[model samples]
Target: MDKKLKRKVLTASLVGSSIEWFDFFLYGTVAGLVLDELYFPSSDPIVALMLAYLSFSLTFFIRPLGGIIFSHIGDRIGRKKTLVITLSLMGGGTVLIGLLPTYAQIGVAAPILLIILRLIQGLGLGGEWGGSLLLAVEYAPKGKKGLFGSIPQMGVPIGLVLGTFTLTMMSLLPHEAFMTWGWRIPFILSALLVVFGLWIRAGINETRNLKKRKNPGRLPNYRLLIH
Candidate 1:
């Protein structure tokens, strides 16, 4: 691969992975800091928190479904379209949560809507992780494969730290205002990151390595390993 092309792929992988994980990591943060009142206000504070955490954790369950659907699409159709779909889903889900009606306004329907949105988010991130890993390492030069894979891997910790700080800052505000509006800023910020990610990812070239492989049939075998 040309050095210029390597640079482009690396940039795309890093940016896209970062944005994807940012949406997911921040959702976990939101669950703890905001979801209790926003979605499930009827429960006792502790119970609401446990429910929020449970809802937050459910994203992991749906992520695998996202991964399988996306990986197949990536293997059959291509990575670019799959990535675009994943990013859009993640961005939309995150932003939707910000706009969601609070339990006080919407009553029983609020948490239900929240759970549905979370599943969409899980699906998006499921695709994001594996696809970013493949996009980074697939075309990397020999012996540097681990390093290339590590670039996308870095996005997870970066996202976690960002989420922690964002929530902590919001937590510092007057409790009412923090609950009312401060949390939305993080979700809305995802839009800017999504645009930036798209700009980088739009330029990534499809891997010719996949093109050379006539045996897409072997892909299903990977599923057993995934489970």
Candidate 2:
């Protein structure tokens, strides 16, 4: 790869991951609090919280699945496509959640829809982190893979912290408005995030390693590797 292009790709890999994760973690911060009211209104607080937490946990647990799928695609096809797909999955899930009706509006179906969206989130996120790091790592200069990988990893904490702050601020609003409408702010804001993630990823070159390799023509060996 050309020197300038490689650096450009590296920047995208790093910044895009940061932005994508920022959007993702935002949902995590709001997961239990807002989802309970929006999705499970008919249930008691305990049940609603429990269900919301389940959905939250599901996102993380499903992350491995996304990793596997994205890894295969990344290793086989190219990093660029995999990242695009992952962003689409996550962005779509986030946007859909913002549009979802509350239980008051849709009864039991609200929580059901929320769960499905959560599944999409889990699947998308599972793919996102691994590929984002791989993209950066593969583009890094000689002997700099470790550093490049770390750079993208920073996005995780940055995103998590930003998400925490955003949620904390939202929590300050009155309970009624916060529950009824304020919760939508974060979800709605994902539009800008998705657009940003795309801009960073746009027109960038594929990872050098992926470009050099021929198709592997097989699913990734992603199963747990217990000895």
Candidate 3:
């Protein structure tokens, strides 16, 4: 690949992965700091907090399923398309979460919806990491494979830093305002990041392997793999 194309692939890989992870981690931060109050309310703050954590844990278990589903699509369609789907799914989930009604407003439905959103976020993330990693690695020149392989990994720390920074800045608000709306801003603002990531990803070419492996009948049965 030419230098220009390589740079575009690298940028798309890193930025797309980072944005997806940013959405994923940002939910955890919100779950820890705000979910208990907004989604799961109890007289015992401890109980509410624990419930929120439990919801977060549930997302973890659902991730594998997401990975399998998306990977199958990636195998059949292409990495580029699969990643676009996952990123869009993740972005939609995050924005919906930001707009979700609180427990006080919706009673039992609040926490239920929160859990569903978390699951969607988990699924998106499960598929995203692998695609991003491959996008970078597969696009690299023969000698630079190792270097490119490591680039997508950078998304982890970058995402954590961005999530932490966003929360910290929002923390500057008073407790009432922070809980009321400040926390939601970060989640909702993810729309812009998602849009940018998708734009970059759209410009990237599918990996050579995916382009060459378009025979669905020749692909392994994902259901068997899952079983």
Candidate achieving the largest lDDT: 3
Ranking by lDDT: 3, 1, 2
Task: Write the residue-wise lDDT of candidate 1 on 126-160 in tens digits.
Answer: 99888888877776777887888889888888778
Per-residue alpha-carbon lDDT of model 3 for 91-205, expressed as tens digits?
9999999999998999999898988888898898888887777678777777777799788889888998999999999999999999999999999999999999999988878
Instruction: Give the C-alpha miss distance for residue 116 in model 2, angstroms.
Output: 1.0
User: What would the TM-score be for candidate 3 when compared with the true structure?
Assistant: 0.93
lDDT of each: 0.82, 0.75, 0.85
Poorly placed runs, candidate 2 (over 4 Å): 1-3, 221-227
Model 2 residue 85 distance off true place after TM-score fit, in angstroms: 0.9
Record all residue pairs in model 2 with backbone atoms less than 3 Å apart, i.e. clashing.
63-126, 66-126, 66-127, 67-126
Q: Of the candidates shown, which would achieve the greatest TM-score relative to the real structure?
A: 3
Listed in order, each prediction's TM-score against the native is 0.90, 0.88, 0.93
Worst 10 residues of 3 by lDDT: 218-227
lDDT of 2 by residue, 6-62 (tens): 677767766667666776777766767777767765437888777777877777778
lDDT of 2 at 16: 65
Candidate 1 vs 2: which has more lDDT: 1
Clash count (model 3, backbone only): 0
